[model samples]
Target: MRLPLPALLCCTAASLLLLLLRWRRRRGLWKKVRAARQRQERSLVQMEMAVQRFREQHPSVNVTSILNLPLPELTEKLRDGSLPLEHVFYAYVGKALQMATETNCITEYLQESETQVQKAKPAGKLGLLYGVPVSLKDSIDCQGHDTTLGFIKNINKPVAEDSVVVQVLRRQGAIPFVKTNIPQSLISYDCNNLIFGQTFNPLLYTRSPGGSTGGEGALIGGGGSILGFGTDLGGSLRFPAAFCGICALKPTGNRLSKKGVVSGIRGQKAVAAAVGPLAKDVESLALSMRALLCEDMFSLDSSVPPLPFNEEVYSSTKPLRIGYYETDFFTMPSPAMRRAIRETKQLLEDAGHTLVPFELMNMDYTLFNFCVKGVFADGCASFLGNFKGELEESSLGLFWLMKSPNWLKNVLSWITKPFMPRLSAMLLSVRANTVDEVWSLHHEIEEFSQQFVAQWKKLNLDVMLCPMLGPALGIGYPAKLSVAVSYTMLYNALDFPAGVVPVTMVTDEDEEELKGYQGYYRDYWDRTMAKAFHGSVGLPVAVQCVALPWQEELCLRFMKEVETLVLKNNRLI
Candidate 1:
């Protein structure tokens, strides 16, 4: 039966009212975001004018020579009082300004760096990084600066205290001079966001630098920063390092004080983010690790294990029993990355390290079940809470899918099963709904990790080598190629330490193979993967080094070994 005319009219009026309210709320969010962006633009202009004046006054300074110095030599000169601290700092500031201008990587200039360097000194035990200037990913807290992870609502709300990492850096006499851009919500690998715009790959203008640490990658890869801090959850640190031909370390979780390091999914410990450094070279990464694991960091945050940098483990000349895999079963690695692994394996063997074939196990259960499902146990309701009044980046589609109701996912999974079974299986894998379900998910994760440990012990492996995603994917493709991170995220699941070093570029043959790229499954995701690698020739590709938990120093050693071997081989050739 039809309702009375007045009651029907009332129902229609209420429906229209709700939509109007939604439209008004969305407009308000954009307005806040626009104001925040205007403030950033104004600050940038002021900083640029100040940089111009400094350049004119220091016209005779050899900024080029200073920028070219290696990290060790640069730090040594500053330590012995041979190089003026102010000169080196300004030189990087100049280059950093140029980098930010080119790629839109910088969020705000920490102009107070000038004041910090003036008072810098080789003052006792914690002065290992004396007079060094560094950059930070935007999610870290620095006193008096906003830690906007590219979200509009996060702007202008500066933190009251420094993050544990920042405090350690300052005490070690390293000046943190700039905060760089990240994807909105810090989820996607692409660097584009609504705030501060997109940060492009420094080498290939059209390619992505990779995220959520893409800004750090771009800056250091372009020679603007010698060392910079970044965090890796899935592949934040390593992806950018590989994509932009830099070096980075993603240490085991709970190894550092993450007190003020922000994450959208806060308090999720099943798979926590690991804080580490991105730099121009492996030695610079090692230097950063050594400085970060000091007494200052220990005292500031007690949760960090009181472990000092193990110099002996790093300096040991004993041969390693290394395990390696060219690719994983979850996603087919690009041809160039597989070649990178093989090349690295031969080089390591030449240097007296034993290499054995290693295959990844149980990714079908691990990828969507434990990681995607368990990582966001709340279905991302809690994370989505942060985006209510914010203009988020476009790449958060996955986050929303993860948050969808089980009934909806199941229906979609069933509908697509015949045509796209892998994706259907992925859709069905989002199982952690209740508290019991989450506990069960953890049990599965622990068991999977143990199985991997069993395999490692059986092989007697001290280190491992593997592929990192692809030869620098084109911009806007990482979201669909999410499965490619299986190579890296396996370590994250097991809480093992890992690092990436640039080793090879995509050769003519590599690109030719990429053209014939047939993915594991001929589904939507795979088709997108093919398109992502279509124009990726000449881009840098790198191999990943993995070690067990709490073996960060040893992991660094493995990375250094690869870097040295590759460079020596290149020189000989």
Candidate 2:
């Protein structure tokens, strides 16, 4: 029954030819990816040069003094005509261009911003954020600019109108000058994409600024922009703020409009994405929230509740009950992170605020089953679908996970369960094949949220203080150590208002102490953490402050308390 040798040889040749054709096709696609990236990079370079020319033409503008004033003070100055709109705008543009050139943090909009500045000068103090230069995360829509979200497939696809958030900010006299970069899928914590390349931390080029709000982290952290906006689904806002040594508030969903923001999974709402501020300090964050939550935002998007920032709650003089935790049940925080929580707890206790011990029961299952699972529902098809032709380096790990067949994943989970329970549990939680399954998961999320709220009520805590995962992770660490975000994701799962304030810096002593530390599971993630944090000395360490839903003002107030205490004690670097 065997075929003749000549016939078999002919069949083998045909197979080889098919393989060659496929390889050539892939090579062609890769060439297109490269060309697209080159175009984006060239635009960035030209924008940088233009900014330089503008700066040289206006040498009298003192960006240093303008940047010195926080967002609130700067707004006051603008309203009183003490700070010229052009001067402030160009100062930031100049600084932002310099930072973007160095860190690759900015995507585009320098030219548009220059035009907006000219327009703002005539309008004069129209509203709260008058004359303020606001930076936007790339996912936000700006008319005439591409809301790429770092995908090559999305490159050059210009949005026709401003997002609701952008419209609201513009009405308040805020000029959206430049857009910052983000990770490819806007899902990973490390900020890099094929289109925008990688955004390096201004502090250390080897480390990541954190994401999906990483560009804001680098730009604002480097003092390029005073106030910026970033959307947080998991730890997007707070993680970058912590990594970059800035402050940010991940407000409850619906607090700000998410109408025109581009997301991989547009309608997935189990752990809803929220638009929030990433800024230099707590005051700037509070001011941004006030401006973003105005009547304009509510009218533009009726889904956004008509709730202005509550100044009274933020300025309360009453004593507070603060609950603090050193570890989420799933992982042990690094020494620097642990110290941040412990030190913040000590400072709060000294300030006459009562500190209560708090713990979330079943954090591991809750995070994986509820938060992480919800995000990856549909097996990450929507996320992967965005990759039209090529894949991003940041998404490789996720791609592997998403592309694997369920039967294979189940088999591997069973094989690993005996030795690696955590990995197995993670694998077991990646459900979402049907509407009924997603519905059941959504119901579970609601139940978990209700239970957690009940626990918070019983504790009677004004706010909770906990460790932000670790100091800024090294570049590419997000791929392997994705679960490290569980600390912040827990808040997202509960839909609580959370903020991160810089408390201290990673020190040699902290690094040395962390070497001997063993986490709750002493697994792959802990090993990866030790490696990632080894050379992270002098990187910022921060703590997470959480409050009940719709209590963003209170969250900012507590964050301000931490920032003040840290500054007073000379804890911040």
Candidate 3:
């Protein structure tokens, strides 16, 4: 087994060379690690300094401290010279800029914040949300500002005219400073676009602020802005507000004009979309709604209803009868959302409101067969229009269907469905309408709406309470896993006025209990729901308060009652 002397010498030289190379590699790696550590330290120091400067520059004023203060009080302060419009505007603008930079919440800035303040100052009076800094979802247009809608190609192309809603807000003395982030194609529930990147939840940097209204949710939730305007066709407004612990109302169709907002499916109006306000409190939402409704929007858009906000409708002495449900029968809500519903029910009942158990049997099939996939039958062509050039990593989910060989998409919809039974049934049941199918789906949707209305009439309930989503999912998971719009979509299908209101926070118990979930939809949705729940510790759990069409006042009244009861019981305010 002994080697020759030459062989031994060669082996010795090779071992020495190897040791030298190893040493050099180790030294280089160490240097990189040290440099990374230094960079991270510097970043931390910069963040702390920025936060400190923010605190010093904008010391908490009595007015700013009252986050839940009614809009009327805030407006009164601005009008009486107790609160300077400039100071309020600057303070919020500063906060939003700081938060947006730190959290990447804002998609595009008008950068004319100072000019906006100057313009509002000479008025020397309050209109409604006087000097209240507002943020809009990127899909909304602000004249001369890019409504990229989160596509990189549209970055420099500014909108020629203001969106009708933006015009209304501007007239009401609200200073719109920035356009917030949105999802690619404005399709998914995850808010990352090629142009502006992802928006993080204000409560947890690691979790998502739901999309496509996610940016507005993140900014407003982080206390960067007092008011936000977002549009919802599916669960865009409700999901973001629920995820970020803000309040929002998706009003009935034609109540608020959607004249100038951009959309993925521009003319695919099978499910109507409404533009609405998102705020820290319900009163702020109402204030914005009232201001927008005041302008007689019916004149501008013949589709808009002339129904003005009625103050008297919400002022009821008698207790309201409310219906509440924990699970949607499509899938059970996560423990936290379930707990929120139970607690909210208890609080309302304690407040002398009658709480009824409401059930829409097989609600998933109703929502699916009618509203969602059927509406997009001619396909998501309009939605898929802006995917030219390089696609962002985030936009990958939307193309999952297209990525499959057309045969696989077709085959999977048929064959692989039985294994993942519930979702398979859902996916298979989704008949992307041909020209003929589109009319049929629309007819089906109408029929479903009629059935739902009949059931609501039978219930005789003022409002129905349900989870905002099934659970508080982690950041990037909704779109990544693709199973978010359950609770909110049902409302869209029915075209009901549904509002999201936060009630409680997720608990350790909630997380622990989800470990044993055994449900029928036991495929992507089940696994995704579990993964989504994993990182969402202590996030707010919210519920949707839904009412009949044109019953927005009743919906608000019910929401106010629920909010009052919850806040008083929890001592949140």
lDDT of 2 by residue, 7-54 (tens): 999999999999998899777757756776676576667666766776
Off by over 4 Å in 2: 1-39, 45-49, 122-125, 391-398, 571-573
- Give the lowest summed-lDDT range of ten residues in model 3: 36-45
lDDT of 2 at 293: 81
Query: Per-residue lDDT tens digits of candidate 3, residues 331-433?
Result: 6578787788888888888778888887778766766566556545554455555665433433634465643343455677777665765545445444344
Clashing pairs in 1: none
Q: Rate the local accuracy (lDDT) of all candidates.
A: 0.84, 0.84, 0.74
What's the best-to-worst order under TM-score? 1, 2, 3
For candidate 3, the lDDT comes to 0.74
lDDT of 1 by residue, 1-573 (tens): 999999999999999999999899889878877886786676567567766777898888888999999998999999988998888887888788888888888888887887787676555653778899999999999999999877777777999999999999998889999888898878778787786788999998788899989999999999888889988888899999998899999999878878899985777767758999998888888888888898889999998989999999998889999999886776877888889899999999989999999987667667777777766777666677767766553475465566678888888899988998877777776534788988887888898888888999999999988788867788777877776677777777789999999898888898788778787776777778878877776788898999989999999999999999999999998
TM-score of 1: 0.95
Question: TM-score of every model?
Answer: 0.95, 0.93, 0.86
lDDT computed for candidate 1: 0.84
